[model samples]
Target: MGPTGTGKSDLGVALARELDGEVVNADSMQFYRGMDIGTAKLAPEERGGVAHHLLDVLEVTEEASVALYQEQARAAIDAVLARGRVPILVGGSGLYVRAALDRLEFPGTDPRARAEIEEDLARRGRSALLAELREVDPESAERVADDRRLVRALEVHRITGRPFTSFMPRREYVRPAVQIGLGGPRGALNERLARRVDRMVERGLPEEVARLDAVGLRRGRTASRALGYRQFLEVLDGLSTVEAAAEATTTATRRLAKRQVTWFSADPRVEWTDFREPPEEQLRRALRRIAEAG
Candidate 1:
């Protein structure tokens, strides 16, 4: 897995075909049912007849929980293995990917505690919560950028009496696995992302957003905030033009790609291939790496 528009979907299909494997999605945004075009979700024909799990399992209004995703993704992988086929986990969501493959533990949440933190957040604001987090968990204070995450960190600290950072996934894999990362130069990726956003708009991202909005897209805490969907939703509200939304989506997607690159690059186990290389060469390198890993 790597950045958006880096051809991870095509690579996953090719690898699944070669290894007789099924694909398990680790992308958080792809979980929603009606978020197709904006998410660049592969159509059924594009999956190359490979069975895919954990896509379109949630409604637009449902909040995505990484803990639930971890359970479902591991079950999908286990089922693939039990059927005598390999499991190819593919997506750009770094934390979800780690939750699927790493030995990460998710602490249970306390709604009462969370509500109290939310109250504090509303009354004292993010800076005050951040200052409090610094006292108990400085690493999470430095890392968390939003109120939702900040509240969750404090809630976890209160309940578990452990730093939120303590729950971070270890580098150790829970099972035998191989990660193949595809990326190219920043300039090329930026151009690709712009082109991709343009294609999405051309393919009717606004209309897609309109349809989901009719079915409560804005009510979704997570799905509504997705890159292109968020921008296009502004178009539905007449707050922005399609052209402006496309531009915003491109900018946001480029930033997301940068973060994805940084996140995946930190993992030593990933064997990266240049997206500028020939598809055949990339596939060969990936297969060789998998063999070496075995």
Candidate 2:
């Protein structure tokens, strides 16, 4: 779970091919139908015959939650494991990853905290709620840099009367897995992101956004919160011009990439590598490491 346009899918695809694995979409927006371009969805041919699940499976209008993702992700993981193939969970969505792995022992959510957060969100807007998260759990607030996370954190704290992150059981969750990361100088990553966004727009990203709107998936859902789509939707809603939408999307995407760098930095398990070479090098290393331990 890194950030937008950080080659998570490319890395996952490369690893899946090497390991006889299936790719599970962990990006929240990618689950919705009509969200292909903005979500940077792989084309059928581009998938290189690699199987992918949990992508383009729902209407954009649907309000999908992390709980729903956990259920679907579990089914996909079980199916892949049953087939004797590795289930490579891949995406930039940290919450989705935590939910799927059940790696986080989220303190039970409290109704009272939920009510208060919702009330604040309703009255003063999301900014206020985010401030609340910042005050209570700075680490969590940093990780979850959006209103959705703020709301979830509130619920978690209310239910447990403790920081939601306490459920993570930190040490145990780090075991039983190997993590590989795309590591480069910050300037290099930013350059890569700029090029990636340019390529996305050239590939009819705006048209993809238009199609989502046509399909009625343009409102009131987690899918709608995706980077490009949300900015483009503002264009679709007359809040911004088309050119302005593109610029806004690019800005938000860069911000996401920056945050991803921070989140992965503390993960000692992740071995940083050059993206220039075939990812097989890292995948094989991880597989060997995991296998040797047993």
TM-score of 2: 0.76
Q: Per-residue lDDT tens digits of candidate 2, residues 1-294?
A: 566665678778877887899999988878877677777888788887799999988887889777677778889988998999988888877677767764655355667767778888999987777777778777787787667777888788766677767765353342255556665676777777777767778888878888877877556467777888888777777888877877787778888877777776766666666555566675666567547656
RMSD of 2: 5.3
lDDT of 1: 0.93
Any residue pairs clashing in model 2, and if so which?
105-167, 110-159
> Where is model 2 more than 4 Å wrong at Cα?
106-171, 278-294
Error of 2 at 29 (Å): 1.7
- Candidates in order have lDDT scores of 0.93, 0.75
* Model 1: per-residue Cα lDDT at residue 93: 98
Q: Return the top candidate by TM-score.
A: 1
